[model samples]
Target chain A: MATREIAGTTVEVNDEGYLTNPDQWNEEIAKVIAREEGIGELTEGHWKVVKFLRDDFKEKGVMPTIRRVKNAGGIPTKDLYELFPEGPLKKSSKVAGLQKPASCI
Target chain B: MMKRVLILGAGTAGTMMANHLARRLDRKDWSLTIVDQHKTHYYQPGFLFIPFGVYGEQDVIKSKREFIPDGVEYIEQKIELIEPDSNKVRLGDGTVLAYDILIVATGSKIFPEEIEGLKEDGWFKNVFDFYTIEGASALREALKDFKGGKLVVHLSEMPIKCPVAPLEFTFLADWFLHTQGIRNETELIYITPLSEAFTKHNCAVVLNYLLEEKRIHMETDFNVERVDETANRIIGYDGREIDYDLLVTIPTNMGDPVIARSGMGDDLNFIPTHKHNLQSKSHENVFVIGDATDLPSSKAGSVAHFQGDVLTENILNFISGNPLKDDFDGHANCFIESGFGKAFLIDFNYDIEPVEGTFPLPVIGPFSLLKETRVNHMGKLAFRWIYWNILLKGRPMPGIKTRMQTLGKRLPKIA
Candidate 1:
């Protein structure tokens, strides 16, 4: 496991730099991770996706897919890409403190 | 003096040619040698299934030596240059190998760096390509936690190996996302430089309809100029921009660099080949096959398989002082995986477009042409087995002819 300091908080990451443990994720850490992903700050739209992903992952023990986030989280399909540029699920799931999704490619 | 036959790149085309020529040519009259940089032989078609976990790492890799016949010498070395005039090739180790006959089968490769920002910041992180083993493995991990957004499958340019692969990936993505219950949330888009879903008009019509049925957006004639990693968008040469949450792109495909260095190839390093005879236009002794040739054929494995038979016959004819048969009709057969346990099979040649019909047999086709069927899916699955055991061995498949068959094809009505 690789470890990185996001907003002064140490987080375990996989080989691809995705969060290995979702339990250690915090809002501050997500902002820092977003900055690292080239996004300056987490907007209100970004938080909606991040919170939905985190809440759903905690409840279902699995990360929420784009459909789940749109249908249950009330986020539109276009807004997801708007909030998280280039690999919204990957970037948002990482910000939400979840493991990297497998097989999107 | 023994007639020496040298084959470059012991991949699909070269390996099959080595096996085919070894069986046909006289042992006393010819000595065969095949050279490749890597000792491992990868089932490249299986790379498509890797990200989906349908094929494991071990399933695609095998020793190149195992495929080479006993009489053929296999050299694991990089080819430095091909001096066609001298009838010899220079190896990376400075050894010169002279040949009476040469076969160039060094296939095409993805040039990601050719596109601006393609190999920059977001490469392998946000932007992923499943064209290679490492790329596929990395993509597999990326897909696991994907919540979803705009999943764009882009083709940087045409003349790519397995032209249907991107379509297959797009279709499979739909199935995968739906299975993960994210299909409705994700916007699936396929962007190609071509004006339609595919190169062939008839096949494109069917494929376009399927794309509409699956709710996948098709962006045609999208000639990508650059990728803005920071903006998460792909910009076209015409200033068209498509935003994507995730992008799977097939970069520009180019032939082997050795061909360019040898000055024996076209602008893209593909050997100028005779479309019907498979012989190099510049050098009579040199024959080109697979993706290495500048022939108007799909750069797919099936074309290589068909070319293998035609090339072997022509090479023998050239040696025996006989007229070469122009039998190679650019016959290409491809099985398109349309997801949901169904696939479409198409058979066509240089002159004919993909039409609705049965393959190999007239009335009774276990496989349907230009139509999706479950049995076509089975045939697609069964091909991987056939590739290793029969295709690689250069053995003839029963009831399958090398040339395109028009026996059962229902041609499209002329307008």
Candidate 2:
């Protein structure tokens, strides 16, 4: 519900710091958000998850679950955790500029 | 030549569908058959009460044969595979049941083996899941011997059946422990993979308040890595650990293995289903109901009951070469047990979150929504009678509607 500046780029974000508009996202914004999430850098594995979240959200109109990311995105859950430490699914989706994954509630 | 409708899994949904189609489809033109491996039809909601000593196994169990409508052939054998390409289902003994239409009602189940060390040394001793009859029975014994340290109730993953059961268990634990004079001694905790106690924003706020009021500790965004039996603690993906005297866990829930064997399911083995019509995404003749479908609705028995109304009509439509009606709105209402003979009733759908209001009546409900009351708990207890007598038989409940009512609901300005 608020706008924030990340790495000299402006984008709207929710209270949880998830980017409200995915179209406003760029590599610079991803890097800055990744840094905020305690992930120092974005590797090839990170972009693979990021790319899947972006494209899948575009097609499905909602954030895919962790199982979907692993099954369809071809990223093993272990590597996903290693790629984005702490919380892989939510963190990756945030860096990917997608909404938080809902629990069907 | 007579057309056949083969229903799978003979559970709550399938039995209802059989009863529905039996009354709807003329016996001269259509024949009905249902299949399952088990003869016992469990009142799944009653499982929550088992651990708290509210209900026994005999109370929840009944002959699956009791609810199945007459003239519908019931096959008490294993379902081997669903060959959607040929519109046939092969049974365990290699018998094939060919059908013009198929209804899948195979519900979700808790799989404890999905996590490392959960089903090992400490299973049923320290770690337990009340989703099954055996698990609940064993947990009853575990609860009996409780002096108490940290009683951690954890949710293993998302999209679980009876989404509110764990929360109910936690609240009931508080009440039970108080009765045993162990409330002060027990450090009750509720853990989840979701970012909050409950997923829906409006409901979460209310539930989180209840958790605080009951003094139950809240832990969020914790994806369990494994249960370390040696140390008697659960390790998270981030290496966070919480020790427990007793661990009541809702393990990974998945669709039946037959869905995977047929190569017709998603990652979780849930068949891809049309949310509105309850039709299979891949095959037109195959319809999915209950937890078998990958619908964004709670996988509770009440949802299966709601789906029963719409799916029956859609099947009748599909039978007569008519277009499938998009009448289902994912309407679901649940009584959330908060213990102490009090509960909260929440009514919601795909687009709307639960709001405060009267349910099924405008300004004159015997039960209130989003507010804990004894009437809601009474309603929940009364549902078991309804489930057995009316719901499973597919008889219409006069007061309830298939779609959600907006009459008494106080809608919030959703952002």
Candidate 3:
């Protein structure tokens, strides 16, 4: 697959709009991938979630579940759903353009 | 016999239109005249940052005459009425200026008086709007003594300049109160008529999260019925009362008074303009731009800049008796300030809503769309300089285009 450029990040999506390279994600593509996954508009506070998700994936080398993303992002469980609205972790991962981690069924 | 074009206001919209049309129209063939009541031009968007001590009054104001080109004649006077049938405009001094073409670019005004009880006792006492030079300066004073309480930032209605400013105010207020050690003392509340914090669904989702994260109280769909200034309470249409110590209300906005006197506007006094062509629905020889028109978009300076380009083409076509191209797709953009030294940029036109994407370039926008970044905050600040030098001078920005592009934007799910 050919690499497409988005804010210095090399992104390649299949017909289903999945990121071929999850590690290649930057802030710009993170928003694009999130919106594509139905996260809608990513606001200022949502950055906390994005940063947390990216950090969790980097350290754990695996995608974080809702519980992990909540703990990592430091946002309350109620606030997480308000921020993601589409069910956190699952929804945010799809929008962040991150590949599904081995932990998630 | 030279063709004379008279532009009614020398503010942001009028100044840009003059700069554009003066260059397009041959000086020998067409005489351009711009009339404004005040000699000073104000950077309106700067008003948003003023209350927070981010921008000073000196940074936002400039002489209106300085921006008008040498070839363009600027007359500082009040317009009494537009005699469109006779192709003449009457001035306050009883001087009748005739024109071959008239451009109505007089921007909007804040009518705080329209809101009962708001202007009577608590005009600038407890309630203030950061939309005008005086209001902004006064709010700065009010903020100085603002120790703590329920600090409510609100929008009276939609169609306000820089729609995100109130949201920006809420964010900045959160940052401001926290820095002052008053965050715990103050209860930050955002009272808007919008179902969410913003108009568009996409942006609203992000804003709702911001309100939640910042611990700012959000009361959506609360249409303010009146303000009980003595009691420091806002009464909503649904009989909901929100108490506040300091009320920063973005008052009702309407088009210039000239539109009402001339009978060229709708109920709200906004000109009825052809959405695409920029031609006034009232007359063929007249055109409307900026906040003067009842366009279903954010009444921001960027939209006027884009309209200036489109109107330039249409005006020439009108002069030549050629078919006018309806090309302006309501391209409006605004940098949403999110405080804590971060901002978000959103660009869209009539058909398209602001979506997540890179702007200017498909994959490499230094500024993020719909997401707050420190760089976007810098861009918003940098625009103040650009407005004075480039945008108002009628020069084309090399990187930025007049048209809104969907190249980088991810298309919404096709329903």
Candidate 4:
């Protein structure tokens, strides 16, 4: 684990840069993470996806996959890609302060 | 009063459960019955070889009744719905059967229709899935007639049954093409939703290098949007398109639709099962095994074989008024056929990644793990016999254990 200064706070993250301490995250951190992921200006559309990830992870104890985010989170697949291009779930979860979805090998 | 144990879907898991309980349960007190719509049981692993003409339909297909234990009643009927609350199952004929215990092994199926335009006119003609015997056979013929063009192997989603088969297919295809004297003419590509050749770190490093060595093109992080049948291409979420002359795809795999109708499955139609004990989260009398459950374990026959031991112990404990055993560690062992008369063996669980080491017999292992060997390839061929004679009969496989074994393995430090 490594520590990163994001949004003026020293928070811990994994080797992949996902937040190790999800509880330490706030909206400010999310915006910074999102910007780094090539997404600019968090719109209402983007917040919904982030909120869904946060809420679902809190309830299920695991980060949801792209299918779950699409099927259960009630977001269209196209909009998700449009909202956060290039591995949307990876970008969204990092911004949402959740660990990477452990893609089962 | 007599108790009835009902098993649904007489595939690998359910059939093994029937045989396991048949002898253990008292003949006078417990009655065993299994239900499935199909009469034939296909050796699913054999399907992978069918495309290369290593296995034929006759070799894989067998009567399901042959493996079922004596005194275990077999019902060849469609299960219409499962009523977990009432401890009953409704058949297609509107007949409801009460169960003291229910084992769901309905398994998963390839749903090509899930994607728009995937099941279009060119489905079997050009785009094919080898998950089924029909698709495998059709692909065999298609490969025979090929003048060698772009052969794209695609994975639509994750958690598909036999997770390694697509990679195996790509490797075998490379070998098959070379044998056909068309290796130079074929442009082979592997497209997946994963960011690399595999999700695990160690395996990915080795597999990615192999892909490069074999000159197979890699397209990663591409979640399929739809199939553009008119143009012979598949469009992903990023709007990236890959054209293919012959598309060998593993379509979105889902649990039986009956789970959806019964209002018990997740978004993918897999039941929410307890990862350790194999019990359904919501229903006490119900247990889930194999691909039907939404476990993190790979959906393969080896997993079902391991789960058989866990479920059997837990069910016996549950029936005897004892607490269920939360002893399953998700042990899964599979041989990755790498072609060129060589294969790789990987054994891991929910926690560990596939690392290099010797397996089963330890340091003196005739078959090495995570390294390609001809012995591993021989193991794959011999498994067909073991699968039918020993595995389905609930006979213990000599070297394997229910939980993941760390002995003889170079264990990785957990992150």
Candidate 5:
């Protein structure tokens, strides 16, 4: 199993550096993961997306889609790009301490 | 002695021709045989969706035997040589099969080694391609960890299968990054040898607008000299450099090596074929289809489907001693995925460029032309099912004509 050092803790990651166990994630770990993803810091807006994704994943047992994120998380399409840069769902999902969304590819 | 028809490859063109000819030709008169190295048939168009994880492995692969109809002999062997003088093909296992007619459907392959440093160091690691199943699968992993950086999507040269695929990848990359929340941090660059975004003038104009809209930096006429891997940049013949953090390139595509060894091909090993009838210029008994033929049309599945229909009739006419008709008009139609659940459809032939139009109907099409719509995206998704069930089986599609029609086309006005 692949592993990554986050916040001085060794966490399991898949071959693509996505979190293997959602339980291993925390607020500090999200900050470290965001930095690694090139997002210098996670703001309140970022946290809103992260929290929404985590809560939705907890309820649905699956990562929310871009449409769901945009609708439920209240993040518009433009703001989503502004926040995540290249892959908002993928980046925010990682920072939000959730598994990679299956529908992304 | 019974007349024999031997097809070289069991791919799209080969499989369709085999199915089409079996029904048309007499059972006792003609014995059809198809030779290919593998038993698995890949829905190659689906390879474009693989890297994006839009399609899984099982979704694109099927047993070749499933599509190859009865009354045809399936020979699983690598071809050794084609002695056109004697009209015989030698298989790798020393079996020589003589044919009354031969169809060359062996398609093009990516020649990664042809480019310097392409196969070295970062291949499948950072620098990757999605042209093959393995390459696409590897790219899925590479794209996962890619945090905002310079992502360069390049085409080594022209005449590659599905020419619009690179642009589709670029557009999807923009969407994919946006979904990953790295669109701001990433710089998406599209490098090509063509002066414009696409092959056609008017189409390139619209595509260039789309590229500008997506903010994908276009570097045109970039004749790649070599990949300077240590410096993480591609050096063109003109000494220009484009650096990349992640490089997804479509390498130089060439016809099967067997075509070269047999002295039956051009500089790129593509068989010189009649653009109209698809018959080989060198031999009347030989017919070429798909990417193997040096046709002026786009080397796409739609062209192959159209050529298959025409070639089937021509082959029958040839057997009956009738004059071959100049039927094939290089008709091709493709759905260009433009990201965000919308896609654009372009339909054209040899003479006409892609114009604003409705397809198969006049101004009341269920699908629009040269314009992006969710319906076109649905059509694009529905095609995979159609390709397997309807197309490969040689069944005619309703309302989709084999010939190009100008009925609903909105032509450019002369100034």
Candidate 6:
């Protein structure tokens, strides 16, 4: 079992190798998970979007749109767009360790 | 009594073996045959640069027979199976090729359909991959007309060829979107099953910083469950889902299907070749190389090139009834594109992971190991040219050695 702290939250990866708590997921969590999963690197912007997705999921029971996330997460739309430039619907969200959202289509 | 050599799938590895063997064996001594269903050959690594308009589709494709030696017989048919014990190969047309030496270079296949729902609803509609010529050309069209929305790149699984390709796509997409002035309209995401940007901790550290600088969002530890194309979402095993307007994915890559038919492959159709000797464990006269072998490393062109050298020596030794040398150290080198027209190089083997060091020579390196530079980017582009002319010809590359050496590599200084 491995334990890591992401953005002030302690996330525990159990012996079964699953991240035990969903709340422990954050930007750092995304980075840690990326390393653990063989995907490389998570930036601060990645954290901002992942955290937004986590928070959005908690609040609305749905993953927020990239546009919705930009405003809600306090990140400028341009920065968010630039961060994802391809749009935030694909593997970027997966790499952030955020749960897939239904409205992602 | 002439010796017969049957080469499977006249791709890079198969074609190179045919050319090399043709030069090695006289017509009086041996007969060589190259088999492939497709008439055209493709430069696979160039697929990565294609969607970015760096390399056109036409630039990467050529006739498979174009590079094969004139003396080598080219068989245009699908392989049915390999009877290794009997030293016989069965073709789709019921033709049997009896061989004294068999080389399995059938390479890999993209099974996007293997992933649940990946090919179901939004396969070509929204989901795309650049690993193939058709996929790349389609992705180019998708990227050209794509105005905003969420764009995602996913690595279906590990051990895929050119592991850094997804990250390169992310960076290039950023560059592409920015250039088109639609940078504000889109969001880019990169999802993978890996813990970091790369397998190596050192490279991951550098790439992590770069991802931050580029503002590319990432999702780690995502084991994709299904691609809900109808709903336009990627669902994970953990019950999370990502919606996308466009999905560029490196779908599940498996060994060539012919391996399974030949009863010479593992669960994924990858041939179980001896890690060191590159020989088929089931048969003495059979050998495997390139993406076909179940080796623990990135399935890149360089690895195939290195394996070619080792297999060449081992094959000759087997012919002479000499003790075979397991000299292949699993050496692999890759040029990583780090966006902004810069790339990085990493050279390592099975024993030594990629470390921060100068490549080729000590004190001065034409290309920096684990560090991004324009020179490395140029080198990445230059490899396509070399692939066609020098590498396919089985000619020796200057300053590049098949075995990995760690002389000038600097160990990380601990505090």
Which candidate achieves the best lDDT against the true structure?
Answer: 4
lDDT of 1 by residue, A1-105 (tens): 789887788989888888898887888998888998997788888887888888887876656555457667898656776677566777898888898754211
In candidate 5 the C-alpha lDDT for residue A55 amounts to 88
Task: For model 4, name the residue pairs that clash.
Answer: none
Cα lDDT of all candidates, in order?
A: 0.87, 0.90, 0.82, 0.92, 0.88, 0.79
Looking at candidate 2, what is the lDDT of residue A18? 91
Lowest lDDT block of 10, candidate 3 chain B: B263-272
lDDT of 4 by residue, A1-105 (tens): 799999999999999999998899999999998888889889999999999999998997777888888889999889999998988887899989989877864
Q: Determine the C-alpha RMSD for candidate 4 after optimal superposition of all C-alphas.
A: 1.6
**What are the TM values for chain B, all candidates?**
0.98, 0.99, 0.98, 0.99, 0.99, 0.97
Fraction of the native A-B contacts that model 6 recovers: 0.00
| DockQ of each candidate relative to the true complex | 0.01, 0.59, 0.01, 0.73, 0.01, 0.02
True contacts kept of each: 0.00, 0.69, 0.00, 0.81, 0.00, 0.00
Model 2 lDDT, full chain set:
0.90
Interface RMSD of 4: 1.3
lDDT of 1 by residue, B1-415 (tens): 8999899998899999999998999889999999999988889888888877788889999999899998998888999999999999999999899999999999999989978899998899879998898898888877887898999999987678898999999999999999899999899999997778898888889999999999999987566768999999999755579999889999988899999899976546778898999999888899999999988898888899999999999999999999888999999999999998899999999989899999779879878999999999999989989999999889998788999988888976677
Clashing pairs in 3: A7-B363, A33-A95, A34-A95
**Per-model i-RMS:** 13.4, 1.8, 18.3, 1.3, 16.1, 15.3
| Model 3 C-alpha lDDT per residue in residues B144-225, reported as the tens digit of each score | 8889999999888666777888898889888888878889999999998766778777788988998899999998766666
TM-score of each: 0.79, 0.94, 0.79, 0.97, 0.79, 0.79
TM-score winner: 4
lDDT of candidate 6 at residue B388, scale 0 to 100 = 96
Q: Single out the weakest 10-residue window by summed lDDT for candidate 6 chain B.
A: B406-415
Residue-pair clashes per candidate: 14, 0, 3, 0, 20, 46
Score candidate 3 by lDDT: 0.82
Q: Tell me which of candidates 1 and 4 scores higher on lDDT.
A: 4
Any runs in candidate 3 off by more than 4 Å, and if so which? A1-105, B413-415
lDDT of 4 at B264: 92
